[model samples]
Target: MASIRISCLLMGLLTVFLGTEVHSYAASFGSLAHTASATATTTTRSVTTTTRVVRKRTWATQSSNKAFNINMLDMCHRYGYNVDGQFVVPEFMKLLNALNRAQCHMASEILYPRDYCLSIKDEDKVDLIVIGSGTAGSLLAAKLSDNRDLKVLLLEAGNLPLMTSEIPGLWADSIGTEMDWKYFAVADETFGQSLDGKKVNVIRGKCLGGTTAMNNMLYDRGLEKDYLYLESIGLTKWGWKYALKLYKKSEDCKFEKITTSKTVKNFHSQGGKVSVDSFRNTRTLGIRQSFSKAISSSNLKTVDYFDVKNHRGFVSSIAMIKNGLRLNAARAFLTDANRKYNLRVALKSTAKRLLFEDNKVVGVEFENSIGELIKVRVTEGVVLSAGPIGSPQLLLQSGIGPKSLLNSLAIPEVAVNERVGSNLQAHASFLGMIVSFETQPLKAYSISEMVYEYLLKQSGPLANIGLSSFTGFIDVNEDGTPDVQIHFYYYSEDDTVFMPSQLDAFNFNDNITEQIIDINENNDMEIVGISLLHPTNSGNVIIEKTDNGYKPVIKYGSLHEDDVTTLLKAIEWFKKVLTSEAFEKYGPKIVPLKIAGGPEPNVDSEEYWKYAIKHLTTMNVQMAGTCSIALNPSEGVVNQNLKVFGVENLWVADSSVIPRIFSTESSAPTLFVAEKANDIIKNQLGCKGSNESNEDDDENENN
Candidate 1:
């Protein structure tokens, strides 16, 4: 999107030249052409048709002095839509983006310019190389290097789990911090409201544990319907039954019953790496009653969906907690806790590209913390675990992308690719409020109160992260897969001050109890987050420039007609929720949530509602499907084992392998992918089989 302006300029200039040509023809033969008006009209129409090709939306233009390159032309041809032919778009995109560099891969060049290449000593060698330290890569490295068989190298651009605060839902803060990749969205009239009104942030975590450490740790095995849909789409083994088996193999849960339990999302196993527990930290009497009433009124009886055998009852959140501590993928995958004699976890190491020879992945190269260039050889294979943003770019850098794109970056073509970084998927989220005001909860939650409670025994406010657990489901469309999902969270603080409260206000209309005669009261708060899952959106991720070091440019490709319909439905549901009797009992004189943080339903104007919707929606951090893994090598980027389809000894082990979006956070899913992928690699190496690939793609691969 940031590059679209540059592209348009190029298109405009091309069109202008064509415009000049048309004028020249008309001006030169005006008298004769006018006399034979019909003939002139016919000629003009033919010329106009030829000239209109330049007017197509996808074309990219040049900067002040730079001219458009063929690679840019190619990018337009494949990736530029909203533009005409995509043949040129993907290439131009690569020029601006830089296809995924190899591990230790650098911008435009390999860590250094041409002048510096001659200075390097060629004796660098490592026994084993792991491209990423996130889910798949981390697990593979932990297992392969556990025997201290040889020196192992892992390269990662993101920050590691270096601090306590980095834990998920810790302070319920850090959503859009420096650790977030913060990608861009393709311009869309349907969801561009955020872009045009407020500079709302689109988040993707860039820290260690990668996105897993930051995602709301909801453990889901996906619905039966989801797998069925995948089967219909030509993918097997991913069906519900097989997926459930894998879920069972990788998970180890304590099975704590959730309170205020509406949906008991079942978890598997009793001794896995993650700590699955129902955090019964605290809940208010009033809020509890209100929630119960709300469920009964909605006729949505709470059910315990976690009984691997039978799912039917209300239970609490079965979170991935171990001894009250988070066991993220990085932690779980590491077999040895202390310094490894043969393994190296290179934190802050950003992978640039995969080194190849005659179409085989040899190793990876990257930039370390000091900004110094480094290279490591895989000897066997190079797997990409940089998630969606990083993986696709890596493919392009390896010359595995559209042919024309590599040329634009001046990158020599190594492989005239198939669908490497072509199909991308993602889901969008919004921070909205049904109501926001001082609550009886916060007043009692002072910092000193936490200190006092902790000093006595680590069992009070100090021990808890203020996020009240959430509930909802993968409600489906006619196709059976969930299209829309609604999650409700307890915002522990003031909403207006923390969120862009200018969005909805009517949901907070003042209400009164028998004790209080008047109804003009506000303070109790709640945030209702409506998400569009299984979105019909698709965007592209390409390598940009040589050394911006700002990660890749992933164009947000979501909010097609279906996605909007789902989002609108989610909104309608929220409105229904607020209108519930449970809501009425709560002292909000404001019967329902407000919009644009503006006037209550009294505003009644459609324009006001539209503005409110625009300000409230945004991108969530759960991104996947840049390097898809599937049974169909034709439609997928990776094979069943998570290895890249075209390149030998090359694989993508992160969230990128998920062929479509899931109805849940991507962290747990990636960890599962790593878990399963490790075993797959092990079997290939003649080792025993264990664990399994644990996740799903964004919601649209079936489409």
Candidate 2:
């Protein structure tokens, strides 16, 4: 009887959860959902409408929702819903289930609510197969598909992003959701000591837009020198001038300051797919202004991050957002019309391995949504855009890594590229350095009120991340290039409950988080992160085949002395900002974050900061260089053309091909690669399709 009750409870919970999800999507996509009253009125005999018209309308109204309802009922029945089954809390469950059913039923009537893309039939062949519709693949597939003559297939391991992802502030909510790949770095004793399980959560977006859908919407193109290293390494096309051109091509610069600036007028572009604009929330403008003043007071000029002449300064960030919605890579590139013919997307399809005919990649084998293994042939080639982690993991799984590892695993070696998963690099940032202010920087509002405000005006905290959008770059060593990037997030006094601790955004331990909450309850706090752009140490990714599938073993975070020294200098730089007249007015002071196994050290001492630096550093998730671009096979997995060595028609166009980690967010660079790859692939395919499209062009879009 107890077992039956437990089973019934779980079944009811599942129904409620799934039902709630459907309603939430409906609320987010208000324009899509149909009204039940309208449906009922249409069904009834209305004097205003003709009988024939009513019948036609009713027939046309039935959609995927009908199938969803049937499937939902079957799922409930299979989970132990029966007339004869004795269950506890029957009345409550029955009431809740009734409400949920009604809500879900209404939600089902919505048209193309989820990511509705063209499905791939078994054994189908395409001109090109772009694996992983991530940051790069999404754009690459769309660009390649523009020919309308060549069939392009884009495979995504995860489904479409939820409507909540459109809100910039809700980015953290998707970290562990179905949208996230949920890759965790191997636990390290040297760092992540205060986090849960001593492990750092490496967030990689699994959905159509890839990490672009789930990450903070900052749109930063690194310094010009960042790509000079690539040019110096024989990748001449990837020089600063060409890289900036590609960035401009992909960007629809909406910021008036950038679009109208005479000095930077040529640096930005219009009519691009990705919309770059300031955060929509007006409430944060005051705080950002204060920060800009504070930065000036610290003797650092406030310059445009996009200006070619500038290398170090504080500036209000521009993000991949327009109005109030996130313009992720998929949304920017893969439009519904694109799927009408040449372009097709297969969601929830995980590419297992590459199928090679001799030395050429001919096709791919992947697991479908229903756990069925299927093979799809490609006429042209395969582009591996599965990101730094996924790309390396797939390569190793296909026996393209070191021969010794493949031999031990008993997998046949496809190639002997020892560098397939080596040279992994990322920006390291310490998260524990914090500052408390005497007054609240910004007022905290309730979720319901914020939602209402956003729905009505499209302006609120939900539309932006407040002062967090203010980012800084510093040339710590006085070199021409910036070595450190500063990112700070503000927590309003009243935000103690609904903050990082509750969301587990950083995976901090309960004790450490609670300490933060205690401090934040009365005083507004700023968590300043100093990112080390250039690190001497590097790590690698290895894959092990499991009964389920291949699991990525990420051996990362061995910080070098140089990295630590740079971070120390950054700490001093930030301290000057705190002491500035603009910030000094707030009576700001450093408050070291509490760590486990501690009597806290003196907050002002260098020793205390060193300890904090050692324990608090975390990856910025701008990971790259696992399958670096080099001159030959011994040095890297891919060459300057991004083609894998010893293999024909197998290209990599993601961060995996980045020769070096740069001092900025990875999104823009990844997109630049996609733009470059589009041209390369077009040149290789001998297609004459143009890459440029107007913003209002209706031929293809992701919406």
Clashing pairs in 2: 334-702, 335-701, 335-702
Lowest lDDT sum, 10 consecutive residues, model 2, at 51-60
Candidate 2, residue 251: Cα displacement in angstroms equals 1.8
RMSD of each: 21.8, 13.9
lDDT of 2 by residue, 1-703 (tens): 2233323323432332333223332132233222121112121212242222211111112331233343644434443333345332354346446544533432332112133233566688889999988779988887788887788888889887765566676667677788987788887665676776677888899988899888888888877677667777887767766666677777898988887876575767899888899885566566666667877754577665555457578787889886576778887877553345777788888999999877889899998888888889999999999999999888888878998888988877888888988888888878888788896656656433354355444578767866767788888888667888888777766362235422366776555555565566567887888888878888889988789877999977588877778888888877776777776567788887666555476666777777787687877878989999889888899876689998899999998889798778899889888888887778778888654221232321110
Best by lDDT: 2
Q: For residue 598, what is the lDDT in candidate 2?
A: 57
* Collision count of model 2: 3
Instruction: Give the true-structure RMSD of model 2.
Output: 13.9
